[model samples]
Structures are given as C-alpha cells and as structure tokens.
Target: MSRGSLFQRAPIPEAKFQKTEDVTKERDADGKKRINQYVVGELLGQGTFGRVKLCHDTVTGNRYAMKVFRKQQLMRKKDFQNEGPGRGMSVTTALSKVYNEIEMMESYSCHPRCVNLVEVLEHQDSQKIYVVMTLGEVGSLLTYDECEGTYTAPVPGEWIPASSQSTQCSSRSSTSRGRSLAIPEPIAKCFIKDALEGIAHLHEHGIVHRDIKPDNFFITTQGRVLLGDFTVASKVDEHGRVRGTEGTYSFMPPECCTPTDESQEYSGHDGRAADMWALGVTVWVVLFGSLPFQKANLKELFESIAECQYRIPPDAPVSPEGLHFIQAVLVKDATNRLTAKDALAHPWVSTADFSQLPAYIEAALKVKEERAKKAAEDASVSGSSSFTGILRP
Candidate 1:
C-alpha cells in the first residue's frame, strides 16, 4: 500500500536512497521522540505515560487528536515488553502498564468505532510518543447536567475527576459552543451497533476492551460513538481462561478477579463478560444519567459490583426494555452475564423502536423548560450563581 501524503518529504541529503523502504507504521520505546509533521492544537488529555493534544494536518488542513508520551517516563521501565509473569505493577513493571495500554489502543486497527492510532511521533524538545486519531468534539454521550446555576454538562464518567471533566467540557465547547446533547435513539442504536461491530472485530482478532466506560466512550461532533482508552485489555485464548484481572474494579466481572472461586471459566475467560457488564452500565447511564450502583469509596464500589447490589432509582423512570437489559447484564456471575451480542439481541435494545415512542417526548426533554425554570428558581434561592454571574467562560 502507498503511504499517505502526510509522510511525503524532500529526499535525504546523504546516500540514503539505497536503503529505501516503506515507512512502516511502528510502535515506540520511550525517550525516542517522533515528530509528526502535523501541527498540534490544544492539549486534549494526559495519561500516566504522556499527553493527548489536538494536531492539525498541515497538508490536508484537517484535525486529529495526538497522544504524546514522555520518553523519560517510558524509559525507566520497559512497558510494552511484559515478558515475565507477575502481579501488581512494580517499579520494574510500571512502564509495562503504559506499554500495555498503547498496544491495546493500537490493536483496534483504526476501527471507526474505536479510537484509531495513526502514528507514534518521536521528534520534540522532550521525548514523546504520538497516537494520531480523528477528532471528537461533541465528547461524551453521558453528559452531566448540573442543575446548579452553572448549568454545565457533567463529565461523561465519574471516574474522571471533576476538574478534568470541567477542562474537557470547556475545551469541547470552545471548539463548538453547544451543550453536548443526548443522542437520538436511532443514532444511539447506530452508535451502539458500531461499537458492537468494533468489539466483534476485536474479538475476531483475539482482543477485548476491558475498561469500557463512558469517559472511554467518545462521540464525534457529528454524533458518532467510539470506544477509547483500552489501557487494561488483554488477549484472550480460544479456551476462554481470563488472562488477568485487568479492568476498573467496579466494571470488572466477579469471575475475572477470582476465577477459581467462581468456577465459571470452564476453560478460560477474557474481558468479554466484563466488557458487556460495562456496556450495560453505559446503557444505563445513557438512559438514566446515573450509575445503577453507588459507593462512598473504591472498596465499597468494588463490593457492590461484585455482589450485584444495585437498584434502578425510583425517581428516574426508564423504559421497560432498557431496564430488562440492565437487569440481565448486571448478573453477578460472569457465566450468566449477557454477552455483547446477546445484549444487542436483547428485547429492550433490539426491539426498542425509539420512533414508535411519543413524538412529543423529544421536544419535551430537549427543550428542558422545566430544568431551566428550576435552575433559575434555585439560583434565586442561592446568594451567587454561575448562570447569574458573568458567564466567565
């Protein structure tokens, strides 16, 4: 295949033509910087190993998300080379965690419904690794609507800090000044289908997205959903033995953390069941704007997830189909948990005909007159309010 125009450059000055070869897409080791010819925009985010920034394709005049990793961080330990058997990340294996994350992101092979890893950039004042990806400005589908005078969209996932959420929400709005809207059911289903397709692709390729969550769930400004941040996924063998307990504690399937006790891995298990659990959680959040389970701390949160101790909030009404699917996927035993495919076929998801619902529901929910009115009332009740204040943003 021919290389994209992005790589075109003037010929080398020295006798290098003899060694001509296609600039193969490559991964990187830390401290070796790969400078992308692309012009980087604002910083999107930072990972333990590096940062993600917006970069412009100078030649094409298009935008892409660029993830830059500090080589200094990666060099202290070998990240990608997870050769030995071990438990938690040691100083020797800390970099390995970052490396595993990069591999997981790249494993998607540029799937439309999964964040694509374009190239790893090396050149910079400081050593960095860049993963180029299509821009997503609308941001998360599970937006938090702070009824407080601020009236700001809540960050998609609770795991992301409030400060981080605020920054992302502000940046996305500055990129385009509109509140991120809840997707239409048709579009929502399409996005879900696209994600399912991506998962199928990964499963076919022997990969699983262990850390599937709303923050990791990104949608383009045009309303397309895709999975991101697969920093904890692992390859699954045919027998299904879970390779490791490598997911967010709350999102992980119980069997994943303790396969021997669960006895669900007749042969083995990967992250599939756990991924479905997270997916179900994602669906619940989309429909009801909250987690089915809540806890004061991480330990309590993990316990709730492991015990399947959750309930649909009485105040927040959800469609019967939606509730049914949530119930099934929230099963504690990984063996009984609904697979993504099965959940896709679930009556609520599959039989859900958003079109058939009252046409007025859209206008009623979208207009948010009640929410707006209530907000103004609350603002009056309070001494100071962001809505009443000078709209600092």
Candidate 2:
C-alpha cells in the first residue's frame, strides 16, 4: 500500500444506539442493553472521559470491548488546558486524536499482533461514541501480577562491596513502592519478541506508535500479545520525521524531552527511533519490574534520561545476553539505537526457546523477515538510480 494511503482518515458511519431508560443500568427483557446488533454487557473499565463495557455480538456469537465516550465530557475545554502530568489538548485536537486512534486500529486490523477494531457506533442524539474492539482477556502488561509494582534495590552494604556501596547503592535504592518479582527471563523474552514484531509491522508502514509501554500491550486467552491504545501515534512524513513530543512522559526518548532549535519547538525527530527507545524502557520494566530511569521530580527524570544514566540493581537477575540487548536499544544516540528487526535478531531474543509459543508468533516473525528483505532491495534499487543520474550529468 502507498504510504499516503496508510494513514488516510476515513469517516466512521454512525450507528444509532437503541434508546432505553437509564442506559447504564436499565436492560431489556433478555437482560442486556442493545446497541444495534451488539448486546452491551457489564462495565469492564472506567476512565476520565468515558467507560469501556463488555459487549456481545448476537449474530456472530463473538465478544468485544466497547469504549463509550461522552461528547460533553470530551469537549470540556478546562480538562484539556490543565497544567500537570495528565495534560489535555484543545477540544478539536482531543476529538481528532480519538478519531485518529480509531482510524489506525481499523487500518491495521489484519495484523496478528495488533488489537483490531470491530466497529464504531455514534449516537448523535445522545452525543456519544462507541468503539467496539477485540477483547484482550488477560488485561494490560502493567496490571498483570508478574509485571506490576516496583523493585527495591538491595541495601547499600548488602549487595555491593563495602568500599563503593555508599554511593552506588544509595543511588540505586528506591523507596517508590513495595517490591515485586520480575517476569522470568524466558517468558519476558516471548513478550518482548511479540512487542518487537508489532513494532516492526508499524515501522514497515511508516507509522510510529509513540506509546509503547507495558500499559498499552495486552494479552489474549490464546497467549498472544497484541499492541493497543494509539491515541498519540502518528505517521512519519516522507523524510521520516514526526513533530511534537506526544507520548507517556516516562516512556519518551531523551530527544523528545530536549528541544532541537531556538524556537523551543521539537523541530521534529526520528519517530521510528523514538519507538525503539520506548520499547527498550518497556523491556526494562518487564525484566526488572521497574523503570530504568525514574525520579519523583520530572526534571530529574528528564536529566537522567538525557544522560542515559541508569544502573541495573545489583541484585536484579538479568543474564548477560539480556543486558546486552537492553544496552543496544537504550543508547542515547538515536541513530545508533537498534531497530525492531535488529533487536529481534539479538542473541538474547533469537536464542530464546519459542517451542511453547503460539504458532501465530512464528508466522509473524517470518513475515517480518520477508518484509525487511524487500525493503533492503528497494533501497538498493533507489540508490543505483541516484548514482546513474549523477553519471549522466
């Protein structure tokens, strides 16, 4: 497909929701809230602007997660102008982002590792929008038991040598939260591989998923990992650039935090490389159960990320290959950072046992390799043409 066609916005047809008294609580005789052909079930999750409800398709006998947005709440100017962490955008921008996410999900629905959008329903009269998507039964990676909570570094004198423990250990020690065990290396490898495959697919299409944290990755009942939540994702231009720094603060790359020109604007950066950095942080959180560079103060956090100053907890259990893989991805230099395909071929990931992984994962890897080969061939042909032009002149 042409790069221009990949991110083209398509208007979603509005579906009229069957009106009922108190739609949130009230149900029909069959004990469900009907919206066209979908039977809206219980509420699955609630957020600032809207809520997600479990829904069933009566005709297809399939289940989906319906995200309902209230137009009034979404249009509130005050919410978008707020100053702090959960900063908002202008009304128009906010609405466009919502639509953009729907467009992206619909455009890439066929990918095996991406959360697919089933349909969108809009209630003009009620001023609401419902987005139906495939359900990720296992929830997000962040909320899962194996990946949640923080890891406390070993006490200064306990893990490190007495001579240098005072400085090194204290710096690594964190009082953030109670400790939790990190995911096992083998299992973490599978999860990271899944994320890499999803990233590879997006990068292949000139799309960058700015948000690549654990919270955005979901797992299904069949044990397949799928990337979801693309509100801040954007397509790079012909020069491979994307403007602004739109992403979760903690997962953003150093370049995103630092302005590029005198105007104080971002001046655009390599969107694909930024994604790899986020994936690096995601991998760190999964294997270590904590962020590699984290601070309560935002300024300090940004400084740490800019300097690439992070230390592996002395007691953290990471193998040599895993450490090497993380180092390659988390490099401060964007140009030197490993791409998704390169990371996948690293010893840490390539050597992992995928014997028990889902069959679809292997299929996806094969597809990624084929696409990479084609991309390299195309680049070679383009280079040859440029050289021929130079000779003719």
For candidate 2, write residues 172-223 as lDDT tens digits: 3444123333555555677788878888887777678998888778766565
Best-performing candidate as measured by lDDT:
2
Give each model's clash number: 18, 0
Query: 98-203, model 1: which lDDT tens digit per residue?
Result: 5675676655455677676655444445354455666655444443333531112222123223443354344233432222323333334555655666665665
Q: Candidate 2, overall lDDT?
A: 0.66
Cα deviation of 94 in candidate 2 (Å)? Answer: 2.5
Listed in order, each prediction's TM-score against the native is: 0.64, 0.71
Global lDDT of each model? 0.53, 0.66
Candidate 1 clash figure, as a count:
18
